[model samples]
Structure formats: C-alpha cells, structure tokens
Target: MSFNWINESTAINLALALVITLISYIVIRRLITAITGRIASWSSRSSHGWTHYLGEIIGRTSRLLILLMAIQMGLYVIDLSPAWESRVSHIWFLVLALQFGLWMDAAVLLWARSALSSKSGHQRSQLTMTMISLMVRTALWAVVLLSVLANLGVDITAFVASLGIGGIAVALAVQNVLSDLFASLSIGIDKPFEQGDFVVFGDIAGSIEYIGLKTTRIRSLSGEQVICSNTQLLQQTIHNYKRMSERRVLFQFDISYRTPTEKVAEVAPLVKQIITSLEKTRFDRAHLLALESNALKFEVVYYVLSSDYNQYMDIQQSINMALLKELEQRQIKFGMPVRSLEFLEDVPVIQRASSDVDESRMVQK
Candidate 1:
C-alpha cells in the first residue's frame, strides 16, 4: 500500500478523537451505574411494583451499547470526507436503533417476570405472557431492522412485500401449530381452566400440570401424564372442579317395613338433625320417598359448603355415623330384602311318614 502521511493538525485530530472516545466511554458507564443504583435505592422504598421492574431493566443496559454511543459522541470532533461521513451516519443509526431494541427487550423480560411472579402455578397466564413477549420482541427487532435498512437507502416496501408473502407461506405450512397456538392464547384469555385445576372432559379426569405453546399436560388420577393438543382440549367440554363453590348431595336409604308408620315419620327429622349438626352442611329436605315390598325408601338432600372433595367426604361420613347411631338407639332396623315361602298343607311330610310307620308296627304286633 502507498504511504499516506497525515499533517500535524490531522494527527492531532485523530489523537484527540481517540482520547475523547475513551474518556466518554468511562463517563457514560459510570453514569449508567450511578443511575441504576439510584433507581434501585428508590425502588426499595416504593410500594409500586413498576419501580423495581424499571430498575431491573435499566441495569440491563449493555456495555457495548454504551461504548458505541461514546464513539458516536467522539465522531463530532473528527473532520472526515463526505463519503465517510455518510457511511458513519448510517452506522450511527444502526447502533442507536440496536441499543433501543436491547432496552425494549430488557423491559419486556422484566415485565414478563413481574407478571408471572404475581400468578404462580398458573400456566395460562405464564404461557400467554410468554407468547406476548415473543411477539413484542419480534416486532421490536423488525422495526429496528426496517428502520436501519431505510436509513441506509434500501427500498423497504418491496422487502416488506416479499416478507409478507414468505410469512403467508410459512403460516400455511404450520397451520395446525398456529391453530393450537391461538387456541392456547384463547385459553389464557377466556380462562376455561388453569394449571393445578382438577378438570373432567369426556371420560378423562385429571389435574392440569403444565401448559405449553401447543399442548397442555395433565396428570390423571391413574398416575399417567396426558398430553393433549390445545385445540383438541378446547374442542371438548371441560368440567372444572376447582371452580365448584358447593356440592349438592342427594342420597337414599331404606328402613324395614316392620317399622311403625310413626317411627318412619321420625326418620326424616332425625336425618335432618344429623346433617345440620355437621360442619359445612346445609340440609335441604328429607322425606319417606316410597314404600317398597321390603322397606320404606327415604330420600335426603343436602349441600356441602365447600369444593374440597375430602372435606365433603368427611362431613358426609360424620352425618352417616350420627344417623346410624341414632337409629340403633331408637331400635329402628335397616331394611333388607327378604323372601319366604309357605306350603298350604295341614300335615307336614315327616310327621305323616312317622305316623304311617307307627301304624304298621302296631298292626305287626
């Protein structure tokens, strides 16, 4: 290469620019640190949740970004050719755009964490937030790229048109996946069921364990994990037991028909008292429903004021035991199916045979 010697003034400009860039980088970094520290201190005393999130995002400011910005400042001290100036301006735009994208990316992450932290064990909200975060970051980087290209004198309309066509092709290729994705998003918004909710759909009953982009995982009562696509899962009706406020209980029992009518009438009152005496139970009605061939059929209706299956079982057991004890004390017997047969003959077979043998012996004597 041919030697190109710089004059004293030009040399001084280059030296001065380098010095300025170094000092500026150090100063900017220190300023970032100081600002982040200040925000952190303020966040500690603030009850507002956004303050802490803001501090975390600010702390993520990149050192490379700071260096680039410092170099941008130093460019003001340099005298350069027109072509170099134009190219440097483009670089400046690209650097600044990229830094902004980074900051926005950090903000998105912080917001997602904050949101997810508030809703622990809820996969619906977490998956929804993650999807949204991905969309936002994608949009941010797209904007940055498009702006950079336009700043460098590239025709973005044709580029965007091409991208649109490609996007359409890709979307068509993954139609099933996209359908499931949208279904999952709908689940997040409509809230049909959430993670950790016990649900029954068709013949399957299980608790939701995880929700993914395309599929939802469930742990069935039989101890196997069920992975069902979001679209298919949503296509069916789901009964969410977690949302139940109370359980309506209807049961029947029978007493021996030998029980007196007066005693039969007392049973309803006894059942009502026994049910009402238990915790979280609301007695609705108790009546002698019908009289069958073998027993008096009684119907009892009540409600357990809880969604807990175990709690409801416990209350029902207590009521059952109490009612049984009361019945035993009152000497009222439970009804059981019974059958008997009687012959319409005056003399039994064995007695007639014995008399026949006795007459024979007397004749012989």
Candidate 2:
C-alpha cells in the first residue's frame, strides 16, 4: 500500500487559509481595540465602564466574523466537492445564526445601558426597552431559523405558509397567554402604573418591578415579590398612589357634655387655625357632630399637601400635638364613657320597713 502525503492543492489551500486566518485575527483584534479605545476615551470612568465592556464584546464578535470569513474563503480555495455541499451549507447556516445571536446580545446590552442611565426616578423605561429587545431577538432567531431551513434545501416559502397556518392554531390554543401579552402591551402604552409606583389593584398593593410579556412583577409592602397575570391586572381596578398630590384626612373626636356651648363654638376656629399653621396641612372644616348620650362628637376634616406617606403622617402628628396643646390651654376636657343612675325614695322595700317600724313604735307607746 502506498501512503499519499499532502497533495499540492490541499497543502496550498491549507497553508493559505492558515495565513489568512492568523492575519485576519490580528487585524480584527487591533481594529477592535482601536475603535473601543476611542469610544471609551470620550467618557468618564463611570460611563466608560460600559464602553469598555462593549469593547470586549466587539473584539470577540470581530474575531468570530474573521474566522467565519476565513472558513468560507478556505472552502473555495480547497475546492470542496459537490458531495459536501449540504454540510457546507449547514455550517454557514450555523455561523450566520451565531453571528446574529451575538449582534442581538450586543444591541440588548447597549439599550440596557441606556435604560440604566435614564434618570426618570424609576426604571419605567426598562419595560419598553425589554420589549424591544425581545422582539429584536425573536426576529433574529426567526431569520436564523429560516436560513437554516433554506440551507437544508427546504422550500422556505412553502414552509413559512404552512407555519402561518400552524401559528393560527397555536395562537388559538394559547389564547390566554396571548391575551396577557397584549395586555402587557397595553400597560406599556397606557402606563396606569410604572416601576416603583405604589399601586393598589383589587386585594393587591405593591410597587411595580417588572412588566413582562405575560406577567407584571410587584414588590409588596411585606417585601415579597408578587407575580400577577397582565390580563388580570388590566381587568382589575388600579389605584396608583404615586399620582396623588394631596391626601385627605377625616377623623372624629369627643368632647365632655359639661362643656359650654360657647366653648364648643370656640373649638372649631381654634382647631382650624392650629391645623393651617402646621406645615403642609390645611384644615378644611371642623364641626360639632350629633350629641351622643355622654359627649359631643366632633368631626375634623383636613388635607395634606404632600403625597409622601411619611410626610403626611408627620404633618398629621404635628396637627394632633397642636390640638392637644390648644385644648389643654383652653381648659377643655375630653369626654369619657359615663352611665346615669336614678334612685326612688318610694320603693316597695323602704315603704315596707318604714310601715313595720311605725307599727312597732305605736305598740310600744
């Protein structure tokens, strides 16, 4: 048996491909470094960190592109026979998919960085960003799949037509998920509640964290993350407390029945003044309500100009303390629970004892 060494055509092709690959790798790597350096130099360290990370991504992508080009060119140089055409097509398809995936990832990362830099007090914009990323990735994957089908010598147009029919059936089967997805879209557009906004819907109360395709995530007051279907959220009544500019407070108190009517008249204006004088609080009205059996019911109505719950509480406390001080100064006393008692001198037992004593006295006389 005679052993055949490397043929002239194969040797030449292999040597040329190796040289080209090495040169392409070196050139692409240097170019990536240069471009990334230029971009990073334009920003401060805080902002440059993302750019640096992006540079590494670019470098890797460039290397991949160079390798792909080298392989594609090397196939022609090596004179690949028609028998291997299907395998070559498959390889190209895979390489194309890989390239698309990498690009999609890079684009998503860039948009994420932009969203992170947005100063909207909350990451509300991230919902839009995420949706866009998902759509883009989906489109990329679809293209890759189509290419793969075509590379495998499948009739892509007919396949797509068949897929459209199947898609209808699938959509019908997953109508609930589709409905929620559309609801998520509505949430993004209508924006009844945004990320970090305190919202109450039905029995749920929480701050929104994530708005996904089918679900919305919330961080509850108990520090737990609550996942809710977007459809359910949309169908329910949503109360967004973040939009509240002012808060209304209605409360009741009690005054002693012994207090004079004139003193009751003085209490309203005094309480109003005390409330209005406090920061961020306005007294709407204070009225002596219906007289109970034991005390006069007083109702106080006020509005706090601030929406912050803590600030509202602070203002309320201040008004409460001022009211207490004013009541003390006016010598006004709060009412306590009381009951009334009546006594009758003509009771049966007393009458009986008195009659018996009188009879005994008369007998002694």
Task: Report each candidate's C-alpha RMSD, comma-separated, in the order given.
Answer: 7.6, 8.7
Question: Per-residue lDDT for 1-365 in model 1, tens only?
Answer: 64368778888888888899999999988888898888888889888877777777778778887888788778878988899889888888888788788889999987777677775535448779888899899999999999999999999999999999999999999999999999989988788998899999998999999888899999999999999999999999899999999999999998998888788889999998898888788999998898888988999999999999999889888888887899999889999999989875756787889899999999999
Worst lDDT 10-window in candidate 2:
120-129
Candidate 1 accuracy as TM-score: 0.80
lDDT of 2 at 216: 90
| Model 1 alpha-carbon miss at residue 289, Å | 5.0
Off by over 4 Å in 1: 1-4, 119-126, 188-190, 223-225, 254-261, 288-297, 328-365
What's the lDDT for candidate 2? 0.79
**lDDT score, residue 215, model 1?**
98
Candidate 2 lDDT over 1-365, as tens digits, reads: 65377777777888987777677667766776888777666544555456656665665574666677666655655666787865876776777677767866776767666665768525355566577677777777788778777877788998899989999999999999999988887787677887778998877888988888889999998989999999988888898999999999998888898888898899889888888788777778999988998889899999989779999888878877887888888888888899889998779988999999999999999
- Candidate 2, TM-score vs. the true structure? 0.60
